[model samples]
Target: MAQAATITIGSKVRVLRVRDRIPADLVEALKADPTGTVTGFRTVDGQGIGLEVDLGAGKGAWFFDDEVTLA
Candidate 1:
């Protein structure tokens, strides 16, 4: 798991896994390339934290903290 203290905006990270259902296109995109840059953070379940990652070529997705690690 990535510690919130260690991750910040613009950090590089890699998708470890998806914990929730997402669009097929995004899933395929992640399969093709799981590494991306952290764009920002979002609230999940009104408590947990989610990371917004830019997968390049206009691709981006939000992932749970545990689903990603510093790359």
Candidate 2:
């Protein structure tokens, strides 16, 4: 995991398009239903950070919380 950074709502985050895992779909789900609980995040070269979001109630998912803006 790279150095953690601060992220806030309304930020433009990237989508980790993992095959059959969690792609843009998951990202949309998060936007639709943001539980406010950050599941996972990691930084990558050029690609920015990847985020795994657990939407709670077994409705978990993953995406790239890349362009997240800190409040």
Candidate 3:
């Protein structure tokens, strides 16, 4: 399997797909514009890593590592 790209704060990324449920507006926004900058990281379930992406216009959301890729 291909390994995911390494990401860090300020890195540009694009949403690949959402694995968890989120607000409808966020989902729509992602579908319309999937690219964003990595703002930070979060611990998910103590085993997974979640990325905080700034979608611009004050819009932001967290996505699992597998849900995004380097842009």
Best by TM-score: 1
Q: What is the lDDT of residue 15 in candidate 1?
A: 96
Please list the C-alpha lDDT of all candidates, in the order they appear: 0.91, 0.48, 0.86
Q: Please report how far candidate 3 places residue 71 from its true position, in Å.
A: 0.5
Candidate 1 ranges beyond 4 A from true positions: none
- Which residue pairs in candidate 1 collide? none
Off by over 4 Å in 2: 1-4, 8-32, 43-46, 66-71
Candidate 3 lDDT for residue 71? 93
- Compare candidates 1 and 2 on lDDT and give the better one: 1
Span of 10 residues, lowest total lDDT, candidate 2: 8-17
Instruction: Encode model 3's per-residue lDDT on 1-71: one tens digit a residue.
Output: 13234688999999999977899989888888999999998888987778899998788999888888899
Alpha-carbon shift of residue 35 in model 2 (angstroms): 2.9
Colliding residue pairs in candidate 2: 16-64
User: Per-residue alpha-carbon lDDT of model 1 for 1-71, expressed as tens digits?
Assistant: 34866999999999999988989989899989999999999998998889999999889989999999999
Ranking of all predicted structures according to TM-score, beginning with the best and ending with the worst: 1, 3, 2
